[model samples]
Target: MAKIVVLGAGLGGVIAAFEIRKSVRPEDDVTVINENAFYQFVPSNPWVLVGWRDREDIIVDLIKPMKKRHIELVVGKAERVEPDQKRVRLTDGREIGYDYLVIATGPELAFNEIEGLGPKGFTQSVCHIDHAVQAHTAFEAFCQDPGPVIVGAVQGASCFGPAYETLMIIETELRRRRIRDRVPMTYVTSEPYIGHLGLDGVGDTKSLLESELRERHIKWITNARVIRAAPGMMTVEELAEDGSVKQLHELPMKFSMMLPAFRGVDAVRDIEGLSNPRGFILTDKHQRNPKFPEIFGIGVCIAIPPIGKTPVPVGVPKTGFMIESMVTATAENLGQILRGEAPSHEATWNAICLADFGDKGVAFVAQPQIPPRNVNWSGSGGWVHTAKVGFEKYFIGKVKAGKSETFYENAVLGLIKTKKIKAH
Candidate 1:
């Protein structure tokens, strides 16, 4: 019997385990390894920072669900990956052998790359639930003494949506509290433009976001590099098209949230031929590692180059829908291999994102997440905000129910003509 091991219990890993179990033979052993036994809905983190959600609202216990599926659950941090031996070594000195391995450890927040950044430093973060909780505590203190607010993504950061959403959500909250006028909000981003989002401004997103910020009286500095952050202050260097620093600003703030750059986790970083320079798993189009075919990578752990060159580094985002497609493709291909057939399936890598701003929001659909695609559409309204809330409830329920892909979910994707897995 083949033993399939899925690492990390984030969105991708959890869904992958369920999907793989559905596709693999019953005799095959399926196991999921995670540092914690609970799954946190990462997308709701921004809401948590603004006091819209609590810890219990987004955290899901995986013990009962995994047990129902008969999937082995190991709670421990991964220390090393031995691809040659087809085994993963846990931090506690235990090894789990696997016929196939799926790495979904997600990105390691590179906060140390910048001086005085991250929760341990001066700035706050909403990347994780714990960070969001910390940020919320800081926000409470900030509200008592309102000052300038700085929010955006640092250089080399790929996930820009959360940064944008957090900024707007904070604005919405402050306005609701009648304290927005006291807080001078400033958006500093590594993106070349306001809405580049590393995909180069999907469907006039530049115009839509620019107008929205302007309407809300939010100022912005694009092509920005955050050199350092200090208590109640941050230093930003705005870059020109020629890659030179056009100007530097010492912005003062009582609250700040800057998304940090991402790299592969420590367990896989030093593994040669398995990861890129940043430690992200290097996979072919089929989500299979070129050097180690038995290994697959999905979500933020996979290496995806920047969409195009910019004045500052901006990595591409691996959105929820795109990662879901990868999970489907990986399951299909692995199932084919088990059935004595050639593995042949590819994920569409389509991106369907909902970026809520508390009251109103933006929704975008890219047929292919990368630029130069077939369909690139973006729209904004209160409906998006409602839809986002509904989506959160639906997704969390699905995870609780141990259902990876539902007929309604598949039917919706089918209606959009975007198959989860397609022929390569």
Candidate 2:
């Protein structure tokens, strides 16, 4: 009997455990290890910050789902990974062994890399559900006395969609409150351009986003490195194409939400040959670690190199579609291994994103998730906001039902049909 373990219970981990449970034989054991007992829909975090969603609205108690699926849940913090021993050491003096392991522990937010940044400091964040709640509190206070607002991602940050979503969402809220004019908003990003999105401009995102910001009277600074974040003030250094300091700007802001860079979690990071220098898991096409074939990795914790050299470091985003592909591929490959057959599945790594503003949003698809793709498409309208709302419900329901349906694939089919109409 194979003992399969999935570490972390985020989007990738939860879905991986469910999918693998379906794929494996009845006698094969499946278990999930997560630091949290509940699952929060991360994509809804921006809405939470704007008071559109409460904590309970997005959270699902994992206990019920795991029990229903018959998948064991080990709710505890992991201290370290002993790859050689094929075991995981818990913080509370316990070791869990596994025949095959899937590591989906998402990125460790690198907020400390900047001075006076993150929730513990001056700025707010929507990376986690708790952070989103705190950001909502700060948003309410900022609305009372509106001033300049800064929203964007810092250097080495991979996930750019949330930053953009939060930026536009905040703008939409400020306008709804009729205090938009009282607050000057600026988008500061490490991307070379307004809509680079760490994928080098999917379709016409540069034009789409730039036009949106202009229409909303929002300012922007690309290739920006936020050096420090003091209360009501931000120190930013704009970088030249040659990576030199071009200009230093002291941007004033009463409220801010800056997306920090991501690195692998402490448990698996520093494991010899398991993680890269930046602590992201090293995996091949099958999402299987080359040095340790029994271990697979998916989602934000996996290492995906930047598309190309940029003025400032901008890591590639592992979008929902891409992570789903990884989970499917990993499950298929593990099933093959359990059956005494060689694994052959490989994730497509496609990128499909829905970046919703309050009333409108943008949707983009990158076939291969890299540059020079077959189906590089992006579109925007009020429909995207509706679509995103549907997506949030669909995904959270899947978590409750223990289903790993190809959510993005199904959504993208309709998007492609729409793209075809536009093409004609």
Candidate 3:
């Protein structure tokens, strides 16, 4: 019997385990290794920072769900992945061998790359649950004494939605507290434009997001490179098209949250032919590592080159639907291999997002995530905020149920898609 191991229990890992269980042979052993015992809905982090969500609201204890599904849960931080040995070594000196391994460890936040960036430094971060909690405390303190606020993604950062989400959500909250006028906000991003979003601005995101920023009286600095972030001050350099510094600005702020660059986690990085220079797993379209077919990768941990050239480096975002597609494809391919058949499944890799602005939001879907494609669409309204909240509930429920989206739920998603298009 093949011992299948799934590493990391984030969005990609958890669903992968549940779906793999159904696809693989009954006798095949399915185990999951994660650094934490509970799963935090990362998309809801911005809401948490404003006290809209408690730690318990989005955190799902995986022990119960994994047990219910009969999937072994190994709770430990992975030290390294010995691909040659087909085993993963944990920090506690324990090791787990496997016939097949799915690496979904996600990216390691590269806060140290920039001077005085991150929760430990001058800026706050919402990349993790704990970080969001800390950021909330900072937010509360800032609200009591409002001043200039800096919120955006730094250079080389992949995920840009949360940067925008956190920016607007905090803006919405500050207004709610009647302290908005007392605070000046600036959005500093590596993207060439306000809505570039790494995919080069899906549909009319450029116009929509720009218009929204204008209506809300929020100033933005695209192609911004954060050189240093000292307490209550950030040194920002705006880049020209030729990659030269056009201007430098010292922005004063009482609160800041800059999304840091991301690299591959320590566990699966730096092996010969196993990963790229950045430590991201090198995988074929099938989501299987070329050097080690038994080793598959999904989510932000996988290597995807930047979409196009920009003044500053901006990595592509692996959105929820895109990662979900990767998970489904990998599981199906693994099932084929186990059944002694050639795999013939490919993920759609559609990029979809619901960028919530607290009370209202923007929603978009890119057919293939990579540009110049069909079905590039985006829209905005209060409906998106409601949709995002509904999705949070639905997804967490699925995780608790130890299942993927059910057939009925899938139909509901289809209906939602129809409604979104109509609203658009």
Candidate 4:
């Protein structure tokens, strides 16, 4: 029986551990190590910042569920990964050996890259629960004295959905409180267009997003690179039509939140041949490290290059569905390994995004996420919100129950069954 070690305990990590549990033999051991006892629903962090959800509502104890799944759980931060030794060193100086390792630590938020843009300043982020709490306090203060607001992801940033989600939720909350008119909001993004979304503009997304922003009176500045940020002001450079010289603009704001470029976690950063310079691990089509077949990575931590270059900097986005597909493929391959067989499969990027637009929302599904793709489609409606909420509930329940594969299979089978029924 093989021993498997998974790191992080985030959505990706927990999902991998649970899937391993479902597939590996009883004698095999699967262990998860994380610094925190509870798993944070990262997507709902925006709601926490907007006061739509509380800190407690998004935090769940991972111990009980992990125990039920018969997986060992270690609550400690990983210090280093000695890949050659097949061991992981903990912050407390303990080391554990494993036959297989899965890196799912997710991306590191590089707030320090931008001057005066972290918790030390007046600006706040919704990247983590703590950040969300601080943002909530900042938003409350803004309510007392409404002013200009800046919200968007920084240059080289990939995760644009959260930035957009946070902006709209803030607008929705401000409108609900009757203070929206008192606040001036602007979206500053590195994308060449407003809706590049790291996939080179998903199917008319640019047009739809531009129209939505105009209709909502939310000003946007694209192809702009943020140089630095202070409490109430930010310096940005607007790309010229020729993309040669940059024209600078200084914008003032009372509140701001910007998603920074992502990098891999510190523990695995220094390991030779283990990660890219940006700290993301390099994995094969099967999600296994090229040098070590037993080692794998998934989610934002894996190094996948940007789709294309735009006037403004944009990194590829690993959306929910995309992340889910990675997890599914990884789990299936690991299962095959446990069964003494070769893994033969590849997972493609199929994005299904539900972008909330205040009271209503926009939904889109683009298979092979990049532009000029097959089966690109979208629709706008209020029911998308309900569907999003339902998906959130379903996702949280799956994590809590430690039924990763079962949940995923049921979801896919249901989709297929629905398609068959419609055909009939």
Candidate 5:
């Protein structure tokens, strides 16, 4: 039996592990390693920040469920990946060897790249539950005072949806708290426009997002390159459409939440020839690390160039379905490897995004996550928000129950193409 080690227990990692277990024989040893035993529902983080949801509501301990799946769970931070040795070194001084490795360590919060911007300094981030907890605390304190609020994603940063979601949720929370009049809100972003969203404005995203912001009376500044951030101010350089830097503007705020640029988690960061300059794992269409055939990466951990650039530059979005598609492809490849067959990687864009706007939300579905898709569609309503919540609930339950087949079927459903299945 081949020993397999899966790093991280995030959405991608957990899904990959479950699907892999389902495909491989029962006697094969499959192990999952992560710093935390619980799996966090990242999409629900904004709600948690606004007091709409508690920390406990979004956190799930993986030990009980993983044990039921007969998967070994190692709860500790992975310190190093000695790929040449085919082993992973843990913080507790344990080494786990594997015939194959799945790198799903996810992204690292590089707030330090911006001067005076981080969890300890000027702003708050909803990237993690702990950060959101701190943000909620700071937000409550800010509410008592009532002042200007600045929220946006930093330059060279992808994952723009969360930033937009947080801004709207905060605005909604303030209105619900009866403090809307006390807060002057501004939505500043690295994107050239309101709806670039890393995919160069999906479907009607540009018009839809802009209309929502205008309706909410929220001021906006786009194509902003944040140079510095402090307790009361942020300095940014506006960019011209030709990719030239424009004048720098210093803006002040009572509370700020800026999404930092994302990089690959540490395990692959310093590895030679494995990751790019930005610290994202360089993978082929199959999500396999180009230099290391036996190693694969999924989700935000892998490197994908921007579809296009605006004034501030837009990065790619790795929505749940997209990541699951990568995971599904990886699992299938691993199954082939276990059978002594050559493996091939093939991933096509199939994305579904639900962007919540407080009381209501927008739902988008695109076949090729980039531009010029086959199934390009979008809708807006309160029911979409309800659907998002319902999907989250159903997803978490299914994951915890280790229902891999059900999850895979639900993920691809009608999207998987039979023609795409070709042997290597």
Candidate 6:
């Protein structure tokens, strides 16, 4: 019997373990390793920062679910990956052997890339539950004495959705508290434009987001590179299309939330031929490392190049739907290998995103996440907000039930023509 190990228990890893259990032989051993015992819904982090949701409200204890599914769970951070020996070393000095390994550790937040940034620094973050809780506390303090606010993603940052959602959500809360008029808000982003979103403007996202920002009286500086951030002050350099600095400004702010760039986790960072220079897992179309065929990667931990060139580096985002697709394909391929058959499954890698902005939101779908695609669509309304809420409930429920796919969820994705895997 093959021993299959899935790393990280975030959205992709948890679902992957469940799918692998369903596809592999009954005797096959499936184990999941994660640093945390609880599965937190990352999409709801923006809500948590605004006091709309609490930390406990969005997390599920993984122990009960893993026990119910008969999957082994190890709560420890991976220290190193011995690809040649097919073993993973945990921080506790225990080594786990596996016949196959799935790497879904997600990105390691690169806050040190910039000075005085991140939760430990001057800026706030909503990327993780802990960060969101801290941001919530900062927001509470800021509300008592509102001032200028800075919100956007830093250069080389790929995850733009949370930056946008957190910005708008903070705005909504300020208005609710009747202190919006007392606060001046500015958006600073690395994207060449407001809605490039690292996918080169998804179906008029440029126009829609620009309109929303204008209606809300929020000013913005595109192609911005944050030089440094100090307490209550951030220096930004606005660049022109030709890569020349157009202007530099020292913006004062009582609160800030700038998303940092991401890199591969420590365990896989120095593994030659397995990761890119940025430390993201290098995988082929089948999500398997060409050098280490026994290893498969999914989620934000995998490297995807930027769609095109911009003044500042902006990596493409791995949305939830796209990551789920990768998880399904990886599980299927691993199952084929266990049966001594050649793997022949590929993930669609399609992008379907719902960015909630408090009362209203924007949703987009790109058939092939990398442009020049068959379908590209986007829309905005209150329904998107409602749909996002429903998604949170449904996804968290799935994690607790130890189920990967559901008929209703599949039907809805079918209506949108999205699939987790495509046989070729």
RMSD of each: 2.9, 1.3, 1.8, 2.5, 3.9, 2.8
Stretches of model 3 off by over 4 angstroms after superposition: 406-419, 422-424
Error of 1 at 221 (Å): 0.6
Alpha carbon lDDT of each predicted model: 0.91, 0.93, 0.91, 0.81, 0.83, 0.90
Per-model TM values vs. the true structure: 0.96, 0.98, 0.97, 0.94, 0.94, 0.96
- Model 2: residues >4 Å from true position, as ranges? 418-424
**Who wins the lDDT comparison?**
2
Q: On a 0 to 100 scale, what is the lDDT of residue 119 in model 3? A: 96
Error at 68, model 1, angstroms: 0.9
> How would you encode candidate 4's per-residue C-alpha lDDT over 215-284 as one tens digit per residue?
7689988887888888679988888656764678899999998888888889889677889898999899
Candidate 3 residue pairs in backbone clash: none
**Stretches of candidate 1 above 4 Å error?**
406-424
Model 5 root mean square deviation, Cα atoms: 3.9
- What would the per-residue lDDT of candidate 2 be over residues 1-424, giving only the tens digit for each residue? 9999999999999999999998888999999999989988999999999999999999999999899999999999989989999999999998999999999999999999999989999999999999999999999988998899999999999999999999999999988999999999999999999999999999999999999999999999999999999978999999999999999999999999999999988998787799998899999988999999999999999998899999999999999999999999999999999999989999998888999998999989888899788878888999999999999998998888777799998888877676631422
- Give the alpha carbon lDDT tens digit for every residue of 10-112 in model 1: 9899999999999999999999999999999999999999899999999999999998998899999999999999999999999999999999999999999
Q: After superposition, how far is residue 216 of candidate 6 from its true place, in Å?
A: 0.5
Leading candidate by TM-score: 2
lDDT for 39 (candidate 1): 96
TM-score of candidate 2 versus the correct structure, residues matched by position: 0.98
Clashes of 5: 1
Q: Write the per-residue lDDT of candidate 6 for residues 1-424, one digit (tens) a residue.
A: 9999999999899999999999999999999999999899989999998899999999999999898998999999999989999999999999999989999999999999999989999999988999999999999999999999999999999989888899899999999999999999999999999999999977779998998899889999999999999998999999999999999999999999999999999999988999988899999988999999999999999988898889999989998878888988898898898889999999888787889999999887777888887767777889778878988898888888888884333533653554322312
